[model samples]
Target: MGSQKFAVLLCADDSDYVKKIYGGYFGVFVRMLEEEGETWDMFRVSNGQFPEDEKVGEYDGFVITGSCNDAHGNDLWICKLLNLLKKLNGMKKKVLGICFGHQILGRALGGKIGRASSGWDIGITNINLQPSKIFSSLKMPASLSIIECHRDEVWELPPKAEVMARSNKTGIEMFRYGDHFMGIQGHPEYTKDILFNLIDRLLHRDLIEESFAEEAKSKLEANEPDKEARKKLCIGFLKGRL
Candidate 1:
């Protein structure tokens, strides 16, 4: 429980809304996981920036963030991110991937990722846990409700990857690729306000129907995500507590 260092490979730029409201995604994530004597640094990988190779070993853990870009896309930055993840895996460093990050990790590790047949899945969803295969140190419930906002999902997991959690909307909601790496399709770092803003943006871009957006918002308002439970899950995994 001494000083610990962590890096966030942020895959998306701060939307104007996020910047003004939550101080950006970095702020959002740090608030969720930061503890005493801990350090958090960020790299905007979506903008083609990354930590230098020599600096990668300094952090105890790395977190990959969500993005608007498709995880399966062949963009230059995305390709570079994939390579970095491969290196992290090779080094056996603790790495947590969220949403787009999850798909990218799956794709990088020889898994199949594509747009979900169910299209976009937004709101709080309950995932069934494979308790036996999961780490016993984790005190998470058999069913977990999390904030979801994604169009793509992992179609097939990489070799040796274990499906730890699944939901009706997605076959692979959460997966663990060895002890050092994990990918979650939902946003554990997101609060209801963040999702609300995101819904507005999606509506403004005409990416989602107004009725669907309203319904999603209503559902989100009706229930709360298991945030503390999620925080415990992410922090425990990163810090070797679970």
Candidate 2:
């Protein structure tokens, strides 16, 4: 943990259970993406916590996590995060955006983002990878399964953005703005237990119908995400080894 410091711009609050078991969303992400000798710092950006301007350059990469809020909204913190993303883009710093992070990166890069007409997409999903040299060295499979839970999506990509993958439910399951910026609409950092807990919470709050929750759980039972492959991709991208 002494080399290659990275930052996580967390966009969601921690559930009590998550805090107790996994430390928090920050801890969950660090477990997924961190490597030996790499330091990871988390800023709870959803609560207006962000690294100071001068501190931005101190990290080698940044990760933006999923959020309950819509990426299309104009909340003050979201606005400020967008500004920071723009600055990061200008600096060519490696940045990985996941879920809401995926949509917000699209918006910040001058794309359209809003509620998906296809409604919510939850559970395991198979995304078809397009032929892209960005991941060529990684030998990624033609298709990969991942945990997905989102009601919003990137409607249009920013200028010069390359769509890397798509699923039956999401047109832009993955996209890249440059060598340094990537956006993924699925939760590769999550395990089935986390999604199960999340589904239960959604059902309890009536965010998702009982039937939908049951179906999502069934799907989770039937399939598993390609975690090792995803970890390789994420870590490679962050470390500039790809």
User: What is the TM-score of each predicted model, taking all chains together?
Assistant: 0.97, 0.98
Segments of candidate 1 deviating more than 4 angstroms: 133-135
* Local lDDT at 183 for model 2: 95
Tell me the tens digit of each residue's lDDT in model 1 across 1-242.
Answer: 56899999999989898888778999999999898889999999998889999999988999999999999999999999989999999999999999998999899899999999999999999988887444456666788899999999999986699998899999999998889989999999998889999999999999999999999999998998888888988999888777
Q: How many residue pairs clash (N, CA or C atoms closer than 3 angstroms) in each of the candidate models, in the order given?
A: 0, 1
**What are the clashing pairs of model 2?**
1-37
| lDDT of residue 166 for candidate 2 | 97
Q: Best-fitting candidate, measured by lDDT?
A: 2
What's the CA RMSD for each of the models? 1.3, 1.3
Question: Model 2 reaches what TM-score against the true structure?
Answer: 0.98
Q: Poorest 10 consecutive residues of model 1 by lDDT?
A: 131-140
lDDT of 2 by residue, 206-232 (tens): 999999999899989989899998999
